[model samples]
Target: MEKYIQEDLDKKIILLTGPRQTGKTTLSKMLNPDYDYFNFDNPDDRLGLQEKSWDRSKKLVIFNELHKLKNWKSWLKGVYDTEGIPPSILVTGSAKLDTYRKVGDSLAGRFFQFRLHPLDLKEIHNFLNPGNLEAELDKLLFSGGFPEPFLNGTTRFYNRWKKSHLDIILKQDLIDLENVQQIIQIETLIQLLKHRVGSPISYASLSQDLQCSDKTVKRWLMILENMYIIFKVPPFHKNIARAIQKAPKFYFYDTGQVIGEQGIKLENTVACAIQKEIHFREDCFGETKKLFYLRNKDKKEIDFCTTSGDDPVLMVEVKWKDNSLSSNFEVFRKFFPQLKMVQVVKELKKEKTFPNGAEIRTAHNWLSTLTLP
Candidate 1:
């Protein structure tokens, strides 16, 4: 994580944006603990910032939560345009700093944004080696990837952390961002989405279940997306026939929050794993990468499809314990001859290559091998 941040801070103003408690501030502070630091959320600190005093000798400065300020874009434009690069600037925030910073004046070329995903196999271990991956993989699945609980490694701690995390995302984060009359309703919608994890999401069914218009349900989902509580991937159909393209599958940003069975739980875990790689690519390296799933009108489906620009490059399927190739895997291989296929099964006893030369490996080993372009 430090390497990723350090790689960009030298050349561009850096914004560390991701879900809450994903260690954006912690990582930022580690870069230069001696640097001048300000948090916009703190009224007293902001008051100090209002004075615009500067330590002329300082080589680094950190501004946290400044995105909440109305004129942050304009203010940053001045600080950056005036100060130049003596004090290399770093901005940190939770929830959509990536989107919010672009709101007012265009700070377009001023900053390089890197999404700090929760701790994962690659971040935690020697990803290339991944020695003794089983224990680490189980711990990741049980504890989820947020810093505190992941470090504490206790069910009791995770339970408390999970409760408090939800409260903050809902009561503090969501309330700050949107003014909706139904807080409890949105909370219920979060739980409903938890159940819908690893399954195709039908907005109409969700709307009917919640007794709200389909549009309202869609809006709520969007709210969750913006808040970083959940993220989704769409269906893939670029060259497929009779493809199901409308539906999406949602996955929690933290897999530990899901109460589903292990099969679905691992599916969400894998989704988050792949997503971390995707974000690192798009956010850090400026790659045109995306995650999607494959399904057809005839009900054939694969768990995920990854793309580079308009072309499909990889297809994945998740099975609880099965090591054999799936039908949809072959379907995608036949349709897209160049697509790389990976089959992840938790109980895979050994890494194997299928007849078509696709790899089947344990989730832990496979996830550890992923890297950004």
Candidate 2:
């Protein structure tokens, strides 16, 4: 991501957005030493931005939390339109800048957006080259993929860090960006989502639990998504509207936030890794890939499905240790015979491919080298 981001910065404005503390600011500073950084949260920095007083001699100008500015898009457009990319413009934010709406002009063709996710199995293995992937996987599942806690490699530290992390994102970031005031309800929503991993989320169920309306629950979920606290995977259907109308599954960006058995955590981990891959393809390569789960009215389901444009291209099922093929695969096979099917198990003695061309893979090995179809 650093390499790709650097290459894109020279040609176009790089809008880097991700979960807070995923190292967006750290990575941006590392890109160049002689860079001027202004954060909108800081009062002095906000003044500087309003006055347009950043050092022009710097190689890069990073406006952290730029989305908070009123009509930020118009301001940034004026900057780019008047002064081209000599001092490269890099906007970093914790919220989704593209989705963050403000009353401003469109920045359609002037910028390239990159969503930075937490370190995944493949990223950690590639960078750190851990000899014991199973141990690393355990640590990742326990500590999560955030830079600080994952590198600390301690459950005690992550336990303490998790609370503060959510507090800041929910109390500070969420309130500031979304203007959402139901802090306690949103926290409960997070806890509710933790248990509901790998299952379709019913807005009515959640609303009932939170003592709110279904519309309020849906809005809160969207707010959580924009803040990168959770991501939803809608059920795959040929009709896009129907797919959205159906119950969709949600997973946390931080794996440690999930509360469940190892099987459920493993499913969340796989979902995160698969989502990271999909985001990479879309961000870096400009591919139109989407993440979804497979389910029907009969409750027959496959864990995940990836599609390119509108065509379903791949199906993935996750299991704890069951090596036997999923009968659900055959159910979906009848409709899309050419789709690639794979079942990844955490504890597999041998990798095998059934006669139907569906493959069973070791979860750790596959996730460490996961690539999109």
Give the number of the best model, judged by lDDT.
Answer: 2
Pull out the clashing pairs in model 1.
none
| lDDT tens readout by residue for model 1, 56-137 | 4677788887877777888888888887886778888886775664367778898888888888887777633545677777
Candidate 1 lDDT for residue 107: 81
Give the alpha carbon lDDT tens digit for every residue of 1-373 in model 2: 8889889888899999999999999999999999999999999999999999999999999999999998899999999999988799999999999887698899999999999999999998899999999888888788789999999987789999998999999888887878888888888889889999999889988888999999999899999899998999999998878877899999999999989988889899999999999999999999999999999889999999999888889999999899799999999999989899999898888999988999999888989999887
lDDT of each: 0.81, 0.91
In TM-score terms, candidate 1 sits at 0.93
**Best candidate (score: TM-score):** 2
Superposition error at 95 for model 2 (Å): 0.3
Q: How close is candidate 2 to the true structure, as a TM-score?
A: 0.98
- Per candidate, the number of residue pairs that clash is 0, 0
TM-score for each prediction?
A: 0.93, 0.98
For each candidate, C-alpha RMSD in Å? 2.5, 1.0
CA deviation > 4 Å runs, candidate 2: none
lDDT of 2 at 4: 90
